[model samples]
Target: MIFRQICSEKGGSLAYVLGDPVTREAVLIDVAENHLTAAEDFLRSRGLQLRLLLVTHWNASHEQAARALRERWGARLAAHESVHAPCVDMRTRDEDVLYFGEESLRIFHTPALTPCASIYAWNDRLFTGHTILVRGLHPKLHGQARVRLLARLCALLERFPEETLLYPGVENQGRRLSSIEEFRRRSQHGAGGDSADLLQRYRHLLPNKRAAKQREKARAEKNLHRYGPGQDVPASL
Candidate 1:
């Protein structure tokens, strides 16, 4: 098995390239548009054929690259069932196993950050996108949903081995990796009932759907203004 983490220098978004060395088959996860060339180059250098493009969540920045990558490599695009992207060739469910050559990844639906959020487990490593960062859990979930999701997340975390390594979507605190045991210990300190109540109390602070849309629109406009027309905008923006 071959694994590499490709991180964006400009934005904090992270992408992964995992390949089965024996079979020469690879899978890319949470790919950003700016990293496409690098990813393709790496695959070519390794003599690996891209077989799958897996997304953990829907982000405008990287989502646009899915179609282009798929068309270029004939790779199948996959994501959680809740993700309504046209580029997705397969809608994955919790516990779904995705196979590429001799490598296989088990899907774990962790909706603490977003409803479409998912984590893929391969061997002792987990590709967790925006769900579990080095700092802690993402703080953008709905009120009651936060509690419910955290409970589910705790349960899921417990299921994994203590030594399992976690590769988060974004690197925080200058660290890109953590272990299930560490996260479990941290979670125990804050995932109690009080934290749930605190989250509920601050529910009003979370952005609503309209605000999120406006923010996205603002970002797109900003990108267009900054990069001008016909330029490939970095997905991190």
Candidate 2:
């Protein structure tokens, strides 16, 4: 099996293509809007036939090119059932397998990051899209949703083998891949973070339902004072 990476300049979003050398059949994972041409070129250059386009989730930034690529390459599009919009040819479930020659992909539902977020393990490699960042800094105010997501990530740490190689959903600051054991240590005792620390980063943002609404109300009033209506508000403020 061969693996290739395609990256987008805007967000460092990565798309992966895996090819079976014996059969020259390939599958694409989590495409970015700007990298479709590169994916096509990689397959074409290897004389491989594109068979599947799998999405890790249904975010527009991640999957806007699904229809165009499906039509162009006659590829079957797959995603989680929760992402029930157009362009998905197959709705995937955890442990479902997609075969490309001798290689088979096993999908695992990982709802920590988003409703439809998932992890795909194939040919001794794990392709996790955006559910865990190997290096990119998570935002400071992602709310309880992010807190819950971190808990899920901890669960995954206890579930998978230590040797499993991780290709995170998004590119790391510079690293290409990481091992599960490495991730475990990094998330537990790293200089600037840990699972509990990660959760704490969002604690203030994740108030109870009533407090959250109240916070939003206060924020709106604060914005009204600062922007004076019909004006743009700064994201951080």
Q: Pick by lDDT: which candidate is best? A: 1
Assess candidate 2 and give its lDDT: 0.75
Best TM-score among the predictions, by candidate number: 1
- TM for every model, in the order presented, reads 0.78, 0.74
lDDT of 1 by residue, 1-237 (tens): 898898878766789999998899999999988778888889998999999999888888667778888889999999899988787899999999999999899999987667888999998899888887775677665457665666667567767789999898887767888888777676556642226455456556443557778999999999988777455655565
Error of 1 at 107 (Å): 0.7
lDDT per model, in order?
0.81, 0.75
Model 2 pairs in collision? 128-169, 129-169, 130-169
Q: Model 2 RMSD to the real structure?
A: 16.8
Residue-pair clashes, model 2: 3
Residue 216 alpha-carbon offset, candidate 2, angstroms: 47
Worst 10 residues of 1 by lDDT: 191-200
